[model samples]
Target: MTVIHNLGFPRIGKQRELKRAVEAYWAGELPQGALLQTGKELRSRHWALQKAAGLDLIPVGDFAWYDQILEWTCLLGAVPARFEHAATADVDLDTLFRMARGRAPQGKPAAACEMTKWFDTNYHYIVPEIQPNQSFRLARTALLEQIAEAVEAGYNVKPVIPGPLTWLWLAKGEAYTQGATDAAKLDLLPALLPVYQDVLARIQALGIEWVQIDEPILAVDLPAVWRDAFKGVYSSLQQGSLKVLLATYFDGLRDNVSVLNGLPVEGVHIDAVRAPEQIAAVRAQLSAEQVLSVGIINGRNIWRTDLDKVAQLLKPLKAELGDKLWIAPSCSLLHVPVDVEGEEGLDAELFSWLSFATQKLDELQWLRALVDNKVDATVEAALEAQRKALKTRAESPRTHNPTVAEKVGKLTTLQRDRAPFSERIAAQQARLNLPAFPTTTIGSFPQTQDIRKLRRDWRSGALSDTAYEKEIRAEIERVIRFQEDIDLDVLVHGEAERNDMVEYFGELLGGFAFTQNGWVQSYGSRCVKPPIIFGDVLRVMPMTVAWSQYAQSLTTRPVKGMLTGPVTMLQWSFVRDDQSRADTCRQLALALRDEVHDLEAAGVKIIQIDEPAIREGLPLRKADWDAYLQWAVDCFRISTSNIENDTQIHTHMCYSEFNDIIEAIAAMDADVITIETSRSNMELLEAFENFHYPNDIGPGVYDIHSPNIPDQAWMVELMRKAAKRLPAERLWVNPDCGLKTRGWPETTEALKTMVAAAKELRQA
Candidate 1:
């Protein structure tokens, strides 16, 4: 019989109870005991819900207050020294809050480590900083307690964890202190192993058979030495405690399959959703003692899995692994939004085609049942649901836009480029009268609570359309005056019309649907409900031209019209299954192309199309990265091409590694590219230095993630570091991303320092 297993579930509760409880606990409205109790209750409720949904192996240890990575940090006592104050048994909720929020007790400044996008998702993780010679302990036994709770509730649980390799690989630290390898400084594994051993002993004592150690980094192109390190660590831990299920997701292991098979773990999990061909190769390579967890369900997307298609994909693995086969999701449910049932306001037709965490649980249960040859009434019901859902979605009028489809097909790749960067830059500089090392923001001022309230009022129709327009325009005018006062070389509308960079565009576009309660946790208390792409995406009207034109009207300086690039919009949304991502992205490009034309016609001098999600969408394997990049670069070009050379297209990419894709970045060929580098101290500039990139560039001089204002000295040092790698004449000065999350005082001070730093460099 095929065992049904869930790799993980959404920790955000049915009604986002976890989010509320965590926030309340942080704000001191709820006691620590109440917070822990809420978490415990949520876990029990989820387990019971899965049981009711007929899941055979319900996963535990997937629930967390903030993130699973942080939980693992606690489990392994891998807390950096900054958060070590929470190590005491009597540690108050204040200590935990401080670690997560980057706040501290009175008289102590916040020692916040940098936060950035996690992989390609909007979600953020607290990056662990490890010093050389760091020691580890079993800090908190959260996992053990969770397991015990599952047992007490009469359900067996599979514990889930981010593998040590992925955890260490994701962490960041200060500059090297000695000749140690970058991986060795955080070699807390030697210390971390005993803690795992202790946790395993308890799990074994409790008779739990399986624990998933997710080593997604195995799919990456790693150095040979790390492969040996992986073997050593797994060999050391395979002491018959809890049977290890070493899982790898996001991409195929390919040549690294040997390293995966070499480990002493009991089973291996492979992602068939992304790379279906991996099954046969993995089946041929499996040893007799090992089990195979076949990842058949799509976890990262909302599309209903083609059951017959996926069932056929799993047949080879079942034939080889036999009863040892476990069917599960490709990865954690974290990437997808929470339960679809909670989306009361979602379009009914669009909702039919989608599955959230709850529905996914039901899908897995039926997949196992069908595989076991017990295909009876229950299985039939699920299959019916799946069939009906697809039928409704496919036939729905919402999915078809003949006009959009026709226009999109006619669009050529040439639409992405205005002109060659050198020519465009020269024309733009002359036309706009920009200063040397011209400074501009990445577009967006603080999304203050008052703005949020007004937006909510407008959205709910409590405020009239005229009132909303007046309020947002006034805000834009205020922003224009501020930029003019600061003598900024370029300006923006501050994006008060936008609630989110992508969501704002999504709202104006046809063939997309928004949800009232589809909030998925981005990081900490923050959440984003990505629009559902149900059909062909097309822009009915210009999304941002009105605001851009208004800001341009208020300023003599060049106002940069902003839009999320096609690749970014597609990556951030839950896209359609019938259309290839490339097709959807092209459709979006066509729509954005119209907007670019509209903006340029409205006297918008400079345009910034932000493709921050470009690098995030890169295939996890090196072999496949190029193909994805080609289409992604083409999408950006297609979107921005309607503008003239003097329009000066700029693009912003933040929280992603661009070193590997420098050529692709160059291929997009925007007049200027601003990237996030303040935290890395312009080490990212080294990518351009290595490639001798020809375009004008902006490596942000100040970190925008933190509230603490960076002074002129900090900005000056960053500029100095960047200048060493980039020519001063080729550089533009900017902040990392936007000032949306920052207060006005902090934003003003930081920009002032940034401008002063640019002035200092000019003088030198």
Candidate 2:
């Protein structure tokens, strides 16, 4: 019989129980025991759900209180020196949270481990810090305990771990040698492999039959040395009694397929959803004894799976490999929401075309039944319904927009400003009449508990529309007054009316559907529900004009009309898969262009269209970047270009390695650009300096992601470092990103210090 399995499942409960529990613990409302219990319960529920769904091999060791990577770091005894003393089991939660979020418990300050994107996805992982004399031991018990828990529950479980090669590849710092390259970090893999070996031995001792070792780095362009290292590491690992299934996803294993095939593992899982063309090639290289786990359902997206197509793809494999064939998702269901069934008030038509994690698992189970010739009448009806929904969505007039398509097709050079950078800067300065070293925020203010409650009440019909508008207006007025009191040069409306930058706009636009429980973790305790764009994106009316006008009415100081940029809107959302991403992005850009024209018409002088996901959307391989960047840059320009020169277009990007894409960034040609630099200590400014970037720039003066506030002197010092590379006149001061996640007390104090620091720099 063919095995049906899932790579992993979302740990956040149907109603986001984990997020609430984690936040409560951070706020001192919940105890450590409570938090741990919540994690245990979530893991238990997820495991049971997979088993009840009829999956043959449910995965364990994928749950984490913070991040799976951070868990792996602690498991390997690679805790950085700062938290080394607290690495004991008694204080493990404290140490792990510190590494993930940085802590100031009882006034004792500890900096967080560095965080970056997990591949191209919005999910972030804590970067492992290693020293020159790093060592590894199997010190943590979470993975083993989870595996044991699942086994005790009477279910067949496959323990999952980041493979040795991918673990070392994702790690940072020159641990084994001084000034080592990322490839050289693999030298520590020798010390790391023993720990993994011990882990496998322990799992084997528990009578675990299979272990899923994830080596997602196989999807990337790897160094020959790293490819060679995979063999040595797996050779040591495969010697254990536990059968190893090497998993790769997120992209095709093109040239790396040969290297993966040569490994002596019992099974190999390839992402057929991402690269179906490579399936035949992968099958040719597989041995008869090796289980071929084919990923048929898309794990990252939200669309309903086409069962007919998947059945066709898997039928030939079943005939050739019989019991050796396995069915799975393209990757972990961690990227998607829990269940689409829980969603209320979604358009019935769109809902029928969507599938969250639970629905996807059902799809996987149905596909297996079809392949095994075990389909019943109920299963046949479900498949038929799926086919009808797919056909309806494809032919639906709701998805087509003749006007939007015509507009995109008739694009011209008018999509760029007529004036050069120098001229445009002069024009903007003349209109706005701001100070040197001006101060402004990226976009939003804190979305506090009270604000969230008000929005929730409004959504649930507990609060009237009149009452909600009154509250939102009051919040906007308060923000404007606070910005004036701080003596900031420019101000933002604080975006109190919005939930997420992308989702807020998506809700107002055509061709989008949102979920009530479609939450995915962006980082520790930060969850986002990415809206689904099912068709051609169109701006039916103005999205941000009312709030922008209200904000401007309260202040003589220029208030930026905050909008999420086209690239970010497309990148952050669950976009349509039928069309090219570039085409979808262009359609979004046109929609945003209409919004920009509306904001400009409302007399909003400064508009900050945030493109934080621009760098995040770049292809993993460098060779594929130029084409992606061309369209991405074009989309950004198309969004902001319709406005006048004096309109002062500003864009914000955060948590990216901007040096590699500085040229493409400059090509976007915003009047001003703000970036996240405080975490890197203004190191990103070097790119602007090297390129002699002429436009105004804001190298963030404070790391808004952290709760610890920077003193005025600290902010001044960072400004001085930025000054070394940027002309003071061209400098703007801002926080790393939106202040949406922060408390009011911290946000107020941080902005006060920031404003004071900018004034100090102006005097200097």
Candidate 3:
């Protein structure tokens, strides 16, 4: 009677119902009640699906309106001071939305909470802001209410919450912001545990037996004090009726395994898929009374699990622990898409090897049945099918391309070498003739609704190629006119014909497959359909040359040939598992290198190869950082170093702390690098200040993620802060990331203000 449960499920629906509902609510097209109803329906549907998959205790409290971390912020009454709310007052839906979006009913909007990548995944979470004397209370009842909803539906529910240690670990304290140590932040745990007790007490009142408290920081290289806090934190937390199953994932717990010995908890979940070698050590640490939940299935990836292999790993454990042995995905299914069943037009052979959230559940059920010696005819058939599918995937001719491999093997340091940045910047300045504090954007302009409809129509054959290109050219011309009118120094094509930055290149490149419904949430209301790199990556032809050429034709200003960098293209997609990530990344780099050659040949003066995922792809452990950074940096250099000095290779990163990785970043040798700093009020520039970074920097003057308009004075002040640290001439004005998600009105106003701010910087 081995139990099976999921740590978390995808919040966005199979067809992305949550995204539609949330976006509609944001636009005032849908009422608040309707949005809430949509959420309820999605939860009910997801719960039913989880039940159908034979989960013993379905997870609750994983669904979120914006982000799971933000939900916890509200639940713990940790809203920032700018919202002007009571510390202990229950956070309502409006206040939660305001914190996420910085929107106010009237007047100027509150500054939205800072957002950054969650662990190493592409998913973004709202960074919780904490005060020096932050006190916590159970301010919101959403978690308890969701558990009640599941119980009402006749399902045993496992309530999920971020562990107190991990929550406090992820939080950005005021003291830390002003240069206090991470160890100092752990001192707030005394005040925080009472709320954790209260929340668990409430769940116990609802008759729930166990709660999943995620403490993923256990996998990271924590300070000794932070590591020391985990035992005390869990010890205090277990003084309640509800049993705590402390979960850690994304990486292995090496020396940290010793910390789990005789822990005061009912169960401990370890990510066996990522660190299977630690299973024995971890099991040895857990007491006989403590349940051991092994995450055997892949949660972050879309590959189908091999039931035979999984059963072998779990069978020994099943005998050892009997009913106490539990199984789940290595992490939350929130990282992957919802279902693969709805995927249309994908290759049958490739489709067989694919698994999404629903399929992962099916794998979990099949594995449990096999390990428990209860495999029925249906389960047996599923196992055989999985066996054949995996075998075929290993032997498929489509998976290999000799020419691609030959090209990658013959690669040399020659391709990675570039002219010095000092020389390159001088050449670029002379070639482009740009002013001081040059104003530009991070590649894309606003992608309007009409452009989306045109793409859909064109792809569906409703619109002819001639008509499609004509419409795209019209949009590009409009973008060029707008940039010139704003007096911006550099311009982009607006990427009118592109659907996604990665997917667009994937569609053009060889050895990639796509799904009609393979959507995963990048952040709130923003979903990305990651391309599946099923084989060798090759540049079949030009990806963005024609678009860049057209935009350049429309403007005397330098129009950047925008391409998603190889490292980003690798990290952002469901890459092939058969090959090493480093090898797959190099293959991608070669492909993008060809594309860069084409862009430069097409006379594109500036080329922005966006490596935003470079930071996101960084390894969690400090010991493992060099190996990852070496390959990641090499891949980026391989893509752009082939171009001339004056081409001005530019890269953009979002929401990362680069103080540690500044040398690796500088090694990429991009002439200009832009990063998101609007949310943190340009506090990110301190890294550049500390290092005296050589290249020009574009510290974003405004947040493009929000709809709120930033005035010229505000933008000027942000630039002024940037100017105080670095040379004013080395600074560039831009907004954070792309303007694709923004509407036309705000995009225009923000760009206008950004350009004006750059001018004011010159005057100063």
The TM-score measured for candidate 1 stands at: 0.92
| Error of model 1, residue 653, in angstroms | 0.7
Q: List residue ranges in candidate 3 displaced over 4 A.
A: 104-108, 177-181
How far is 501's C-alpha from truth in model 3 (Å)?
0.5
Residue pairs in collision within model 3: none
Query: What alpha-carbon RMSD in Å does predicted model 3 have with respect to the real structure?
Result: 1.4
Give per-residue CA lDDT, model 1, range 63-180, as digits (tens).
Answer: 8777777667666665556555655453334544455556533223354555666665677776666665666676677788788879878897787777766777776566432113
RMSD vs true structure, all candidates:
3.1, 2.1, 1.4
TM-score of each candidate structure, all chains considered together: 0.92, 0.96, 0.98
> What's the ranking of the predictions by TM-score, best on top?
3, 2, 1
Model 3: per-residue lDDT, tens digit, 1-764?
67899999999998899999988887788888999999999999999999999999899999999999999999998888888877657888878888888883433468888998998999999989987788788888887888999998899999899988788778885466522336777778888999888888888888899899999988987767777777788888774578889999998899888779777889999999889998999999998999999999999999988889889988998999998899999999999999998677887888899999999999989998899999999998999999999999999999899999899878873557877777888888899999998888887777777888999999999999999999999999998998998899999888988899999999998899999999999999999999999999988888788888888988899998898988899999999888799999999989988888888998998999999999899988889999999999988888876688888888999888888899999898888899999998888898999999998999998998877788899999988899899998888888988998888888888888788878878988
lDDT values of the candidates?
0.79, 0.86, 0.88
Judging by lDDT against the true structure, name the best candidate: 3
**Model 1: how far residue 579 lies from native, Å:** 2.3
Residue range 624-646, candidate 2, lDDT tens digits: 89999999999888887756778
Name the better of 2 and 3 by TM-score. Answer: 3
Segments in model 2 whose C-alpha atoms lie over 4 Å from true places? 84-91, 104-107, 174-182, 412-414
> Whose TM-score is greatest here?
3
